[model samples]
Target: MGWSWPANPALWPLARELVKATETRQAAKSPLPHERETVAEIRHKTEASNGDNVDRTSAYLTFFRKHPEVHWALLAHLVSRNAGWSMTDLRGELLPRLLPANVQQDYFSFLERGNWLIFHDAYPQLLLYEESVKRQTTLFHLLPELHVSVFMQAVWNHFWKTGDSKLLTVGLIMNEQHYLETHMMSDETYQTTVVKTLPFALQEVLRLNLILFPYRAEGQEDGALRLAGAPVFHFASLAERIELGKRLYSLLFTSLRLREGAIQWASDKPHTGSRKDFWPHLFHDLRETAPGKAHQKKLGGCQLLPGANRLYSPALRHVWKQVRHEAPKAADWYPATKGVMRQLLLSREQPASFCAEEAYCQALEKIERAVLAKGKLFGS
Candidate 1:
């Protein structure tokens, strides 16, 4: 679909309603000033970086600052796009030199601290293994977290390793994961974006994910992350899969809510064409074209992911079948999933400025739109 604004005046009615709904909500709440301005700032960057020498960081932040969840979905898209060449270039040329001095120092510290919200550093061994797999014959692990990080880093590292794209990508994913995890699980009190550019920093890494690991390696084997002949794909049969999926799902929900809340805020904020006007139409378009939305009605109602036939893999298919059959015996899975998302919304940390909050909201909203379109729960 075209990213350009629709030229047809016919579509404006939907867009106008979006603006009204979004702005009306803000007017009632006494919206901040900075929040209103940043939307324009982001839009400017997004447009500027659309050319040949696309500022990977700018394009991603422009997209992510408005839609954080797209970080992953798009990362996957990019990974699968150019056979890892473009992403490799981005990692090599941009990541290391991208940030300002203080931002760089703070980013490194965030990872070192492992605060779980702003930074995530994978074991160097995992990186080594992933590289070996990409070039050699090592058994690729199916553990989603491990697989995701490796995919993100390998593509990033493939372009260049002069600095630390591996670590940077890990940190970026962890930041989003933590932000959502903390917000979802915490109460009404929590600090948002411990540091500025936190979301933008994370976006950079996500863009790299799309550059590499875009597709499931055709000949790649599965079931490596599983234990002995338990139920191949279902969480019920595999203890590790169940535990991980549970955590991953929870994290995704938190990320989703955080993102949605941000967008809601952005659409309402002042300046930069009405985000409110843009949202509903975007959602409408998404509902029809999003890769994820097609099966939402069916999938949303399913009790077990493994039981759903929508999964693309045989192993995954087997797992869902088991999960569906065993779900009656399982306790409530919604608490960790749904409850957390609600909690994150209720407990958002106040931003440093109105614009920061607005930016955060825009970033989150962008992700939400992508998720709605793609139907994936996890954020990049």
Candidate 2:
């Protein structure tokens, strides 16, 4: 049977209170009463901040200055869709109110041009919060036995969501020797390159439970189910998320510059035997560190960047190469591209450029034609 998640509008208030109380109790555990008091005060302030007649901009500015972490929690509320804040509201009002003028303008310009908000720095806190909520409510609770609470928090989504509300489920595939692996087993270059970087990604996921899923064993005794997907983590309150976001935002900025500089530096150097192999690996490393979908959205202010042809073509080629014998012509690949591209366009600050628009449109057209061709061949 297919899966579906029906809206539970009635649960909003109950869920909100549960989240608040849980957060407060967790905060009170701190040795310092001041920390606890600050948490409590923030909660009260949050209640007061939601006034219909009051100026929300001023309220947010003041609240943000004092309790920046609240932004993470509030964002979680927005992301979870337990509250009414849409992407439109976030783009139009909340973002400018929180971010600096220059940052806001840069992002706004990007949004004005059609682009996908998939990069890491462009994420809005609200969207990150929503993904976190979904991860927790769906995956986390599913595995109650595993204690992954420490890594679960509001800011983790800064590392997750694809800026298009397309949830990313990361799997850190490992082998018996504790080395990382990918599907490209025969290719030595792909395997070696993936191995080197896989550990870092694995460590990050393990440390925070930010990105997690399960993989089943090939051969299991009596179908014991060797691997079961679990809930990664859960944050105590929205405040923690905001605090986490501040820390992560700074780190993300540094990481981006370092990556750009490395790419430039590698390009300048003379390549020898090992360096030839290493250079491409360096690009792979850069891709790993590249900002996630959420960051791209908020950073570009909602720009619709072009989809990676290199990425799409390879997938299409792989499917055609591997499965063409069974399904001579299949349309499965096109929908993924169409859906992602459409989402990217919708998230863009403006329509894409002529070239980019034409390319994606053509890509879409090709996929549609492929689907039709398959339908004619199969008569299904």
Candidate 3:
């Protein structure tokens, strides 16, 4: 069944109570020493897992396994895997040919910062939820002490009462994207150096903004993997990003084939921050050819073209060092209740098919052609 914002008038009073309670807690005196200790422990855990992409990815998966009702953890794990793939792609064979070293580094910083910031904000909330389950009570009022957004305090409270995983997932998707809009998307440095740059513009034009969820169907000979996901569009718009995330959630959970298959694949395969995680036939963590060597086509509509060398998609540890990020700037982007309701309503759209393997392959070909053209023109 398609999920929607609960229309029961009785629930409205509950939501109002949650908001008032959150505000009261926020206005309360400093946390006692015991509360301080708990906050510190969660912070330490969040930092430990947030050290790098692999650590963060595994943390999300582990949390999801333990608390499957928190659908956002699983979704975050899959998307975090994609973020790692993108980080490696910057240092991969094709992109180096297309982008200068400094430009590549800058792009990595941009992606890494977003990944880090989101984990910083979201992991504590997950841990708090775990604590709540353990204590058999809702402890989301402590969210403010952890620097979590007030938006989530209400949603978590609502989920505690209703066990509505879909609503909580949607709430999280909205919260994180809105969080990014404040911290990363609007920053002048990122705007001037990353988002507004030609390379960033080219990413959209080349259809490189894809988020793939891969799964191997049952009884497929040779364990052929299939990908299902929609490309992100109009990323500069917060609404578009929210919509894209909702679509991904729908695609991941609504289809039984995809949900079961993706879960199995994630279980069987540990992420190594390489495209090889999903399509080892095309991508390798090690270099397959000498630098500047002419290469044959490697893909044809998601299948390998005959005799093509596996493209170099290095693991994250090989290509990049772990980043030590400054604490994210504090701010809340929560909208009025009316705006929240509107977003929730909009999140209830029909599930759209994200089987775009052919399109993804086409994008890869475009990048390959561009690289070849550059080599020919510059004689590098």
> Which predicted model would earn the best lDDT?
3
TM-score to true structure, per model: 0.18, 0.17, 0.93
Clashes (backbone N, CA, C under 3 Å), per candidate, total 36, 40, 0
- Highest TM-score, which number? 3
lDDT by residue for model 2 (1-380), tens? 01112144432332343354335435644234643443344334533433211122223233333433333322221111211111121222123233345543333232211111111111222222333355453222211111112112211222232221211111000010011111122235433443234432442344322211111223433212211111122222222332333332222223434223322332332221111111131112112223222222111111223542111111111111111111112111111121211111111132211112223233323333443454457542
Q: Give the lowest summed-lDDT range of ten residues in model 3.
A: 1-10
Q: What lDDT score goes with residue 135 in model 2?
A: 49
lDDT at position 57, candidate 3: 93
Q: Which of the two, 1 or 2, has more lDDT?
A: 1
Clashing pairs in 3: none
Candidate 2 Cα lDDT to native: 0.24
Whichever of 1 and 3 has more TM-score, that candidate is 3
Cα error, residue 198 of model 2, in Å, equals 52
lDDT of 2 at 180: 10
Q: In model 2, which range of ten residues has the least summed lDDT?
A: 171-180
Give the runs in model 2 whose Cα sits over 4 Å from its true position: 1-32, 61-380
